[model samples]
Target chain A: MESTANNRVIHVRELVKKFGDFVANDHLNFDVYAGEIFGFLGANGAGKTTAMKILCGLQRPSSGTIEVAGFDVYKQSDQIKKNIGYMSQRFSLYEDLTVKENFQFYGGIYGLSATEIKDRTRQMLESLQMTTSADMILRDIPLGWKQKLAFSVAMVHRPKIVFLDEPTGGVDPITRRQFWEMIYEAASKGVTVFVTTHYMDEAEYCNRISIMVDGRIEALDSPAALKAKYNAATMDEVFIRLARAGVRSMNG
Target chain B: MRIIFYILQKEFRQIFRDKVMLPIIIVIPMIQLFILSYTATFEIKNTRLSIVDQDKSTTSRALISKFSGSSFFTIASYETSYEDGMERIKTGTTDQLLVIGKDTEKKLSRKEEASVLLVTNAINGSAASLMNAYASGIINDFNRFILEDQGPAGAVPALIAVQSRHWYNPKLDYKTFMVPGILVLLVTLIGMFLSGMNIVKEKEKGTIEQINVTPIKKYQFMIGKLLPFWLLALFELMIGLAFARLVFSIPMEGSVVLLLGIASVYLLVVLGLGLLASTVSDTMQQAMFISWFFVVIFILMSGLFTPVESMPAWAQNLNRLNPVAYFIQINRMIMLKGSGFQEVSGLFVALCVYAAAILSIAVKRYKKTA
Candidate 1:
């Protein structure tokens, strides 16, 4: 892990995002190393999604020097988009399309050859044990299966980084565990995972996590280290301590 | 280019899979064409006429026979009193009243003019005017007949005659004029609504975000979004043209290829407008309302139901910005008059410029980042 620490996939310096007078991400600074699962945790409207959007090149920051997959978010956003994959919580896959068709379409747009797409699609379906359901329309599938398929489709292009925005929001805990396993597998293959979530238990699965409070990162380190520093029993307690401080600042 | 191909493939698949949308794209326009072409017309076949004949003479009887014999007027009743004839018109039972004055023949024989009164229901202004024209024409023919009969062969005063001929449509079949214009309308409807709703649907479904985050070029995505509807609209125009030719037997005097070429360019303008509407709107409902607002304005001002020549000068000036008006005019000229490319070259250039301008605006407005 120490040997791979020098390979920085995401670098941010003094990132400031303002929607009118309200700053969504204020002077944020962070770096995500290669093959690392970086968890972004925040309560609702804490600006986690906004920060993730900026990192994915889905939005332009009001002011920032940010980079994703070694490409500058401002100048090389198109190149950054090519190297990164994104899946939102809104279920972005086409419900009318079949599982295999979704995979082929996402792969094809990324300039993958037809045979390569077919091979990867078959491999993905077989691994997910969804081979028989490949031809089934996506709308008929269960929500958990759809979530899994969306993540796999996001990886169909073999992007260097995958941005999952609340990828397991509505899924069962068992399914979320499986989702984490998939994320770990991708990370093992040197695909950096940038995921945002509300579940503190899920944050424990990250090698290192950042807890954002009121548009700023209040704490960022390994979950065990954050718990130890806060003198808390679990990540949940650490999160509560930081979030209460954010609440105090709001009232002040 | 390959990316565009895949996007088109995905879009075509989704469109075909929607059973509700498929029929709307293909069947509804044809139904509108068949119904509107027949129902929306200017030809007044039956105008009920009542006669108040006070003069019981050969001249008056001959005139009554003239009104009854003509196909334009159906004599609803014959009354002794003028009030009774007018009552038929007031009650909506008759469209016009023809009153023959007393001693009309006696006055004509004395080489003096005889006056007859025609009271027309001017409720519907244009229809009333047409009925008036037909009645006056028949009365003129009667005067000419009386002149030829009463005077010596060469002693009749010489009068300048106006022989009017209706060209392009010799028989003045209304469908020949209407079908081309309606065809332009249906094509515009399909192009504008489908392409506009399509992009907004992707936005609503959150699929647009997925496509946006990809490395796909903006032009490639736009082309993918628009080309399928463009082809579908052109195909619809072809089917409409075939229906026009076969069912109505509307004369296609112009080159089919030229009409289609012009239609293709016109479709770009319409499709671009739809795409533009999609970019500004978030939901399919908003896009539909925006499209409806524009479509209603364009259709009314398109000269489809009324002649542009008769429109107020300000409206005519405003119509210079109307793409539908330009295309309908081009369609009528080509299909009815057999106009060549050279004849419509100026309008063709205008359409080209409009297409380029509208499409670029749509492209520019569609923000990938947003």
Candidate 2:
């Protein structure tokens, strides 16, 4: 198929990452279009984090032609960083800071003016119905609220892409649903969502999903397409089918 | 510049929010200054003396009385036999023993030379020299007393009466000498350990992952990491100097501004060392251990408790690179000797060079990309 480079926010060609003799990403090829919820599905040790880090400008790729937001990873990582937001399973909000303060800090570091940070912080607190908890320390907030606050803070700069590395790993189903709704809202606003999750049910929420097995992309298609291709009834079955055929352990 | 200010704001907030750390950073060092100054002394008091006078004459008794009257010596015993005086010294009951030979008064009356034997415990060599000097001073006083009693007409002038004037600290107060050194230590510890552990704490908690992904420059991050502790260390120095003046009555011989200016550069060296430690270790424990290893070395060799002049030549040469040593030396010179900027400029320049080297190394080692 002919590729549409203008529509793609992320382009990875012949991507390879290695740690010593171990290959974490083996010559992967993919493209993620703008404003799409792209699910990067993998078991533990399937090089999910290594690839995410490379894309986030937090790790160097051993060898690859990877571009995010139209900036080369090797030469223009600073530009790439300026145009991306990141949230992780281990939340990045400072526990010592108030909810409003956390928003202000992230906004300030992202090069927002003081007046802009002040305005955005107030708007964020009001929108989340967290005006009452704005002054409350993050450590005192409920975990679900903290996760939501972390997501909002990560998006404070409104970058073109947001990388979510298992962003809802330990949340209840209701909170996870709420978090996915936030992702969808962001995606609707022309923000590309690149997320990784262990939940097969959550994987079904993506527009396109790629399953990696043993440092290589084993399948790439929509949830229904992948299920049909694997002759399976559920994403779990599809995942299990591919995972069992792999040699790398979940602990790798 | 703006990004670095954000980091500084975050660090200051976190530091002040920690209730346990606030007191540890400010109060503990003040308490240490008060307690350690009084106890860290070199003054030797109450040297126990034993004397065996074989001559049993009035002259011998007068000489013995002189030793007993002196405040430096406490006459432990007046043993008649030499063996008893020797036994007292061997048992460590007496620090020194004086033995006056037979017919000491008869020899003086005949204008012949007289002799006395002085023995001291040389285990502590410095204290032993002091004890020997005190003993000889007492015996010389007795010789003058005898000559005056024999009706001499303002006899021959004595050999070289050295008029010694101790400048600055005329009283030779060890507290005056030690207070400034301890202040350097407090500042160095606060600057090094706090900043060192701060970065590693973020690393251990995985907060650095988000920070690493940010567009902030490396120098901006390092400046943000260092500024709070650098300011805090200077504040701690102020408290230390205040205590030195009010509590110890340590006179501020030089300009407080000059002292603080030098201390500010010294803080860079210490805080830079902390940043260096953080870059080498991934965990707070590892960072603490690494910083502690160097802190202990710097403190011991800082000329705080012992004179740097007395240390072996190689150790002293190695001390040229030690920031603590330079700070301690500069602090004492300024506080005790009333030294001017011109006097401390060499050390000040050395510290600036050292700080620049270490901080640049730390910034270089700190990886934005994992």
Local distance difference test, each candidate: 0.92, 0.90
Q: Worst lDDT window (10 residues) for model 2 chain B?
A: B151-160
lDDT by residue for model 2 (A1-252), tens:
223788789999999999999999999999999999999999899989899999998889999899999999999999999999998668778899988878877898899999999888888888778889989999999888888888888889989999999988888889889899999899999899999999999999999999999999999999999999999999999999998878885655
| lDDT string, candidate 2, B1-370, tens digits | 8888889889989999999999899899999999889888877668998989899998888888888888998989889888999899899999998999999989988978899999999999988988888888878878777766775666755556678898978998889888999999899889999999999999887888888888988888888888999999999999899989998899999999999999988898899899889989999999999999999999999889878899999999999989999999999899988999999999999999998898788888889986
True contacts kept of each: 0.84, 0.71
A189-249: candidate 1 lDDT, tens digit per residue: 9999999988888999999999889999999999999999999999999998888878524
Please give, for residues B1-370, the per-residue lDDT of candidate 1 as tens digits: 8888899899999989999989988899899989988999998867898898889999999988888899988888888899998878889898999999999999999999889999999999999999999999999999898999999989788989998899999888888889999999999999999999989998999998898889999888888999999999999999999999999999999999999999999999999999999999999999999999999999999999888899999999999889999999999999999999999999999999999999999999999888
True-vs-predicted CA distance for residue B157, candidate 1, Å: 3.2
Docking quality tier of model 1: medium
What DockQ would candidate 1 receive versus the native complex? 0.78
| Complex DockQ per candidate | 0.78, 0.69
